[model samples]
Target: MSKSNTNTRTQTRASLFTPFIAIILPVIIASAVLYRLDPLEPVHFPLDKINRSAITVPLLNKNMRLGSEKAAEGQVLGPEDLVYDAALGVVYTGCEDGWIKRITVNESVVEDWVNTGGRPLGLAFDGNGDLIVADAYKVTGFHIYV
Candidate 1:
């Protein structure tokens, strides 16, 4: 109410707000300048293009439900890639636990085939019955198992 008291209050307010403005104004100005300049020049990859194809894919049946059966008992963890060997009557897959596993198509038999000591991602069989496995992280390359 008094002039001296009002002036003192106004000065205190100004003093308290000045430091915030000093810090905030520089940030606002730098943001504006960086937005204008865009020094980093961000690159966005066409992830959708890389991930999906142009062809129309069939919609999955909504009524489909997963069967209640454990394929391999604890030995196979995180199977990534699969290959079928018609001659051997088996389906082979590479697992994250650094082991190649084979399970029969009928889900009757499961076997541990190979251990790369690294994560295995993909598995394939050549004409000569050589199994090629793509191992990652520690091994970093392909290994052929005969």
Candidate 2:
């Protein structure tokens, strides 16, 4: 190839990369900013340490297991807390996707009950059978009808 043609091709390739760099740079910066912001801050709670010696209980026939397999439904991202309703037999879990999930306790089936439009932390059932959620972004309580 001629020197002029090679130089032109090099310049074109460099120019093509410029736009990609421009697009990717902002994405990287925004990701850093979002990481700093950490919208799920309220939901992230550290667990209290367990003191084994202080506890006294009768030994059971069943062995204590560490963890259980999550249901076949896609995993719940950033699950903060969970509350169970005895009457309805449903377990509500706060998730990072700005949604609260209702799962059947026996079957481990999950469904998106409601979207809070914000990250939910704690959940409780009121006397009226509505689920009250503590949201991270909003001060008002989120109510979910059963």
Number of backbone collisions per candidate: 0, 0
Off by over 4 Å in 1: 1-70, 73-75, 138-140
Tens-digit lDDT track of model 1 for 79-140:
89988888878888888878788798775588887788888887888778888777776545
Residues 1-146, candidate 2, lDDT per residue (tens digit)?
99999999999999999999999999999999989898674664455544345667877735565465555256677788989899878788999998788888788888888889998999988999888899999989877777
Question: Where in model 2 is the C-alpha error above 4 Å?
Answer: 1-74
TM-score of each: 0.48, 0.51
Computed on alpha carbons, the lDDT of every model, listed in order, comes to 0.80, 0.84
For model 2, the run of ten residues with the poorest summed lDDT: 44-53
Model 1 pairs in collision = none
Best candidate according to lDDT: 2
